[model samples]
Target chain A: SQQGEEDPQALSIQEGENATMNCSYKTSINNLQWYRQNSGRGLVHLILIRSNEREKHSGRLRVTLDTSKKSSSLLITASRAADTASYFCATRGIKAAGNKLTFGGGTRVLVKP
Target chain B: TAGITQAPTSQILAAGRSMTLRCTQDMRHNAMYWYRQDLGLGLRLIHYSNTAGTTGKGEVPDGYSVSRANTDDFPLTLASAVPSQTSVYFCASSDEAGGNYGYTFGSGTRLTVV
Candidate 1:
């Protein structure tokens, strides 16, 4: 079974609108990271928020982690057509060995011009 | 930095044949991982190596094997392909700590077992 799961399998919005995606995990984690994947390409690391941190910002990306609820959310401000892609959330467990990242079922976002 | 590279962008194999997918990372990351992505399903870890000469199974390890003979290379093998195994295979690398830096993924290899 997958440790992390993303909600809202797909989303569609206008170019300038903000898009939000949520992820929930079942175990205690040291950190949570978000990634973007374009068609035919590999995933690109976007932002990582530690368990102790409540919120983080990078460019137009905003990530919030609520360790108490074991969930995280990614908010993309002023989205663009170029930002249309699949977003995935990965969880790194605190006591897990190695650098294993358990990914969730991604949410595909489509931005219309 | 070349990052991570995977070979045979796409491949088609018979159900009973064997094949090897190659992955190499120029970053010299201490940890490397193999994952498979299917439609509607996120990437699932197949195998991983924390360091040279040590490999461990991930969420889904059946029908797959990996070897880390050197720091720069990690290859995954399928000893008898099945249609159920057809999916996009990704190779990723990360620093020793694994969590803080996130992961760097390869371009991915699309495999089809018929």
Candidate 2:
């Protein structure tokens, strides 16, 4: 089984509407990172939130993490057509010797323009 | 561009032939990693090198092998290609071991074995 799993496997929303996706992990982590993959392109780094941090924002992307719940959420405000991509959450284990990351199945999001 | 170049954007190989996917990054990063992306399985780590001259096995390292001889290049080789090895391969690198900053990924190579 994967260490991290995402909810709402797929999402579809209007261009101006907000889009939100959740990720849950099963173990302790040092940090959590979110990535976006546009169709055939490689995964692009979005945001990284440390275990001690609660929330962080970049441009229109907002990310929140809850250590107690072992989960995280990514929210895009006023989404645009370019936001149509698959979102994946990766976790860096706290006890891992190296900086290896465990990735989730990902959430496929589609923005209707 | 973050200075990562992946050669042979796509390739088709015979089942028993051997092939090597080339990956080069100009970021001078110490940690490099290889991962395979599938339909529903997301991405699985194949192999990683924390620094030049050292390599380690990842979550899925059975059929794939990788080597980081220097800081600039890391290549993944398939000893005996098989149909099951077909997948989109990605090469990623981080400034630090944990990507405290972020991970830079290549455009990716689409591989098919038949």
**List-wise, what DockQ does each model earn?**
0.77, 0.68
Each prediction's Cα lDDT score?
Answer: 0.93, 0.92
Over B1-114, each residue of candidate 1 has an lDDT whose tens digit, in order, gives 679989989999999999999999999899999999998778999999999899999889999999999999999999999999999999999988455779999999999999
Q: State the displacement of the C-alpha of residue B89, model 1, in Å, after optimal TM-score superposition.
A: 0.1
Q: Tell me which residue pairs clash in candidate 2.
A: none
| Candidate 1 stretches greater than 4 Å from native | B97-99
Give model 1's TM-score versus the native structure: 0.98
Cα miss at B26, model 2 (Å)? 0.4
Off by over 4 Å in 2: none
Per-residue alpha-carbon lDDT of model 1 for A1-113, expressed as tens digits? 67789988999999999999999999999889999999989999999898899999999999999998999999999999999999999998998887788899999999999
User: For the second chain of model 2, what is the TM-score against the true structure's chain B?
Assistant: 0.96
Residue A78 CA displacement from its true place in model 1, Å? 0.6
> Which ten residues in a row are the worst by lDDT in model 2 chain A?
A93-102
